[model samples]
Target: MERPSLKSWAEAAPRLVAVAAGRDTADLVIRQGIWVNVQSRELLPGHDIAIAEGRIAYVGPDASHCIGDKTKVIEAEGRYMLPGLCDGHMHVESGMLTPAEFARAVIPHGTTSMFTDPHEIANVLGLEGVRLMHDEALLQPVNIFTQMPSCAPSAPGLETTGFEITPEDVSQAMQWPGIIGLGEMMNFPGVIGADPKMLAEIAATQNAGKTVGGHYASPDLGPAFHAYAAGGPADDHEGTQEADAIARVRQGMRAMLRLGSAWYDVESQITAVTEKGLDPRNFIICTDDCHSGTLVNEGHMNRAYRHAVACGCDPLVALQMMTINTAAHFGLERELGSIAPGRRADIILSSDFHALSVETVIARGQVVAENGTITVDCPHLDWPDHARSTVHLGKTLGAADFEIPAPAGANGVRVRVIGVVENQAPTRALSADLPVVEGLIEAEGAVCQIALVERHRATGAVTNAFVEGFGYEGRMAMASTVAHDSHHMIVVGTSRADMALAANRLGEVGGGVVFFADGVEQALVELPIAGLMSDDKAETVAAKAEALGAAMEAAGCKLNNAYMQHSLLALVVIPELRISDKGLVDVTKFETTELVEKVLQ
Candidate 1:
């Protein structure tokens, strides 16, 4: 089931030429439509598109010459015919579903192309995991390009992942069928410091003439930012502010504005194009980390595109950012992002540009979706039992495993707490004074206990710390194996008993997310595949995720998409504060720091 390659196109050139000239019939024809020409940034009315062999043969004012008795004709009826939307950057694992299920969820929303980074799998199973994901991606009906994971531990000396990706791995992955380039280089500090290993990974991707992704999470626009830009990353999607976006594009990197399940970064960064009037060509739209609920209930790339338009960007400008700009950024301008000749026939028919109501989707010269319903099957891989049984906790844990000892003879201790910011990724490093009971420190009012349990090695090692901003009360704990960058277990709770129970439950169910209150199971979403994704349908996973959110609310924790924040508590690459298997990391300093700053007098 391999699609047409360059050689196939050369072999079929004469047939396509005959079809365009009306000597032979086209396989499909779209007539009476307003064709959106993304290359020229204009819309041409009453255009006819002739398709043959899954590629566009002709696009003009009429296709009567190419029509035959057996040809399929789609009457666009004056609707706008746009190129299928493209997601410039995303991760399939973040949706809590496999690549097949993720494709099934987004096909109805008009996303025909996805540039995905499977670094989460790299952290778990290394190169083999990446290959599995890549093989599955190539089987889908629409396009799903894989990027070789560039950083596994994310930040060296600060965290420990189950597996690490080396420079040789990048070189080998470049030869993969679906590999687009190296994934996001999350180790910005390593690149700025001229780490030889990091540079070698970048060089491998560059040598293959592929794009290098970026992840500069810090807000500083100082010398480090310039050094990272010089290190060879071509685009970045981690900008959370107007300045961050401007800095990236100014440094010759494409600025990716994302609107994910929890990260509301588009409104702040879209100002670079909408208000400040920066070149829109250097900007693109993406959903960095969207869960199944958001993909099912809301939209995919369509959501980000509409958000940009609502933020005052021109409708055509927003569309270009999501379509042509994205394709051009990946060096795929000729293969996608337009309805002209010599491009893949991936088109969407919509009645309105403002609302972006996708009415019909044609991917690779075939009708794949119509009126918000999928018409084609998204193929799935037969994942082995070992892939589904990755959660390994050597021994069951008790309440004592989560306890933190206080300084001797101290009544209270001031501890550095990771503060969760609503609708953002970076956490604020704050300090809180908590009371000491007996010889252990106890969580006071708003502060709660957070622990990083090492589930990969099954050694039962736990690193404990404190955190705020979820506003959890009562005896409740939330545990997840979907911790970012490193797929370890992160448990945050007010009670140590509940924490241990929730963590042990994930190990029992293979791996997934669980919420516990008063030692009672409130909700669970089992992601048995590599402890990161589910094999179920997207709608089924979305429903379970919704229930998980409700359970978090019922436990007195109220933050927007709080589960997203919960998963990133252990991400040591992001700025400010984070926890890892090694210890608490001060990400800005790129080193581990003490949990307690000072002791009480």
Candidate 2:
């Protein structure tokens, strides 16, 4: 299908204005509402909205003159009429659903626009993956713009991916329809060092007059951070502190605070606006990564709004962060971000601003959702066979495959461990001394074994390492195919037998999450689509995910959102320690580390 051209929308403006002025009739009229004008930050009561040809023709005191006998009328009944919410940065694949299903899940929550980066898929399928996500996004009723993925391997030499994206790929994608801008450049070090590939991608985005998204995961706000900002990323969502937020805005970059399924970054960062009294216009709210469970059980943008309100942010200011600020950041202010004349007629009606309970949703002059239920069609794409058959475990494995050998004749050994920080993406690089038994090193107290099983190729290779902070107490193990970026298999367990069972179970069911105890499979969430997402509805996936969480708790692992930590074990971009198919990685130094030291007792 051909994309609707901006020229067509421009040419229809005169006829649209005539309909607004009562000289002509409109297709739809929304009557008697309190308009929450975001531009002026005022609420005007007893206002009516007139729509013609899927564009807002008039927004004023009365639209009765423009309402013809054939025009459909929607009675707002004194509700607050506001612009539909926009997610400034997110990953649609993170929802564990296709773009169509993701839109269906969020529409009732009053989210009409999203800026998505499909880099997760790009890591697996390259440009074909990006085009698939982009094409499906344009087919939705609401606006789902795609930001051409900037980094595929995310970090070039840090880890290997099923496919590698080149600078040529980035430049070509910028010209595609629905291409908003470059995706988040996760290669902060590369940008700071002026790596040719990273710089070229940024230059292409700038030359195309589009936004360059940023992701600086380090806590350092020093010279490296400054250099990354100078490398040309327009916005960043990796800020986890008030200072991080303040610094970004002070440097003329939009600070995006995210509240995803497991990432609780908004509370810590919103203080930049609520208490520090910084200009709220430079801030935006987003859900960087929300799984199917969160989208189905909790709301999407509505959840972010409520969280902002809970953080002591004013209701209007919170709305602005999710709506106007986001639209303006992507250069879509005039086209969207408000319920005013000439903007796309994407609006939401709610009884209260504080609670943000969306009673109805209007998009492109049509009612799409009402009272927590989607009332319109969101078409799904037919995923090809190649997408489904992606999980490749090189060989079948047994318990012996997971054994970690200690240095010869060593009584004790010092081991580097990856520490899982609760509700945050960054992990702690910790080292611990442990006793060795029979030349085999075992995870003794809070530490457990973490293995990255190569699944992309039938390599059946397991790179073993140690991880802390999960608080696991017994002979249990957990396995998941949701490893970030590469989406490989990650298994963490105290017992080798249980670990083997959990790993093989995922291979059996194609891909998803599994938990095992005492060599018995306890729980599983079957995500058959691309081994990354589930074809089941979000509610169904949520129920299975809830069961998986309960199984984790039952197995003696206690940590807030430990499943999120499990999913990121293979994400080599974040600092400290991570396991890839090659070996254990010291991400802080960006070098491969040896599993065992050459020493003897």
Candidate 3:
């Protein structure tokens, strides 16, 4: 699909002025709406908005002068006319859908803008992959900006990625049309230590006058955190506490509260503004990672804002966080974030502020969706053959590949177990004692075997560990190629045979999440693009994801959005424990540790 040639605001200013002065007619006009003024933080009833050439030409008490015979007028029915909501930070691959599908899914929910980091694909396909996502995003009718992935193997030396994002890559991407800023700098320790490479990447983005995204995934807000903030990250979304939010804003950095499919962080952090008297301007709401089910069923930016309102944030303040605040953070405030003159004519009409049931969605002067149905075509890229085939296990994995051999001459073993925390990114580093059967230590109760299978280089190496929390009962297995940061294949299950089957199935299908119980395949969501996203429609992928969740519950897992938890198990950057292609990682210590703690006789 050919991308639309971008028209500069200067080129359209003369016509916008003419329309506002009543010398020219607007292409579209919306009348009789209660304007939700994000900029002034007030509600103005009986307002009209006029658009010309996909940019707002006039906004005030009346746009009657700008209306002509050809003008498309929409009666808002006293609905709140809001600036289109924006997702300040997210990953399109997290939805398991490509750019086109993601836009299609969210447009109906009033998400007119998206700022996405394509690092998931960058880990598998590198610069070419980033370009693919960037180009496709530019073709969307709504705003979909790309952030050049700054970290591939997010924790360097902890794991290896297919390709690394260097200062040169960052510099080159800054020149891309859709590239908004550098993706989240997940190497917090490196930035704090002033690692030359990490600093160089941040410098390139700063030099280009672009925002440097942040990921300080630690609870330690000490001198280390201060040093990291000084190293040049513009915003952070890893905050899980009120103190974290206040700390970031105090340091002149935006505090991004994220509410993804699995991570519920708004209620804990929103109190910084709701309970405390902190200014809300510097606070942003984002969805760091959301799957297709969440997008299709719950909502997008609407979901985030509604969740914030539920957590006691003012309804108007929440809209500001999702709209102008995000736009200003990305240096796009004058272009797309608000419903003012010269800004993109992206607006939503809703009857209720609390529920935000999107009745009509407009983007760039076009009614894109009405009553929860998309009216425009979201173009797709013709993905090359290489992009579709990425999974490569050196050979067929078998039951033996997953076995964690017990320490020699031991009746039982004390081992390091990863404890997963529901509705959060951080895991717990735990110690557990389990009896050995034959030559292997068997995982019991809530514990399950986890193995990271090398897929990028097909080394046929598996790093085995134990994780407790999924509560699997039967001989069940789950495997996914959507493992965070590393993009490797993570297989977890009680039965080694089923684990082998699950891992091989993803390999055969190229990439996706698969579930198996009692040696039978139960559900699968095929993500054939770099093993991260599906090129199919969003609804199709959402249905598969929904089924995958049901199958997970049927296998005795009680965690909400367990697929997200399974996919993030390989995120070595976040504390306290994670699995990587190399070995078990103690994230708090930022190093690998021995799997077995002690030998029991």
Best by TM-score: 3
Identify the candidate with maximal lDDT: 3
lDDT of each: 0.91, 0.87, 0.93
Model 3, 1-601: lDDT tens digits are 3457546789989999999999999999999999989989999999999999899999999999999999999998799999999999999999999999999999999999999999999999999999999999999999899999998779899998888878999999999888889999999999999999999999999999999999999999999999999999999999999999999999999999999999999999999999898999999999999999999999998999889998888999999999999999999999988889999999999999788989999998899999999999999989999999899899999999999889889899999999999999999999999989999989888889998999988888998999999988889999999999889999999999999999999999999999999999999999999999998988899999999999999989989999999999999999999999889999999999999999999
lDDT of 1 by residue, 1-601 (tens): 3433322467667878999988999999999999888888888899999999888999999999999998999999999999999998999999999999999999999999999999998898889889889988888889899999999989877787889999999999999878888899999999999999999999999999999999998898999899999999999999999999999999999999888999999899988888899999999999999999999999998888888888888888888998899889889998888888878889999999789899999999989999999998888888878888777788999999999999888889999999999999999999999988998999989999999999888888999999999999899999999999898999999999999999999999989999999999999999998999998999999999999999999888889999999999988888899999989999889889999898996
Give the C-alpha miss distance for residue 101 in model 1, angstroms: 0.2
TM-score of each: 0.98, 0.97, 0.99
| Candidate 1 stretches greater than 4 Å from native | 1-8
Q: Model 1 misses residue 566 by how many Å?
A: 0.8
Candidate 1 residue pairs in backbone clash: none
Task: Report residue 209 deviation for candidate 3 (angstroms).
Answer: 0.8
Candidate 3, run of 10 with poorest lDDT:
1-10
Candidate 3 stretches with Cα past 4 Å from truth are none
- In angstroms, the error of model 1 at 415 is 0.3
- Deviation in angstroms for 214 in model 1? 0.7
- Best of the two (2, 3) by lDDT: 3
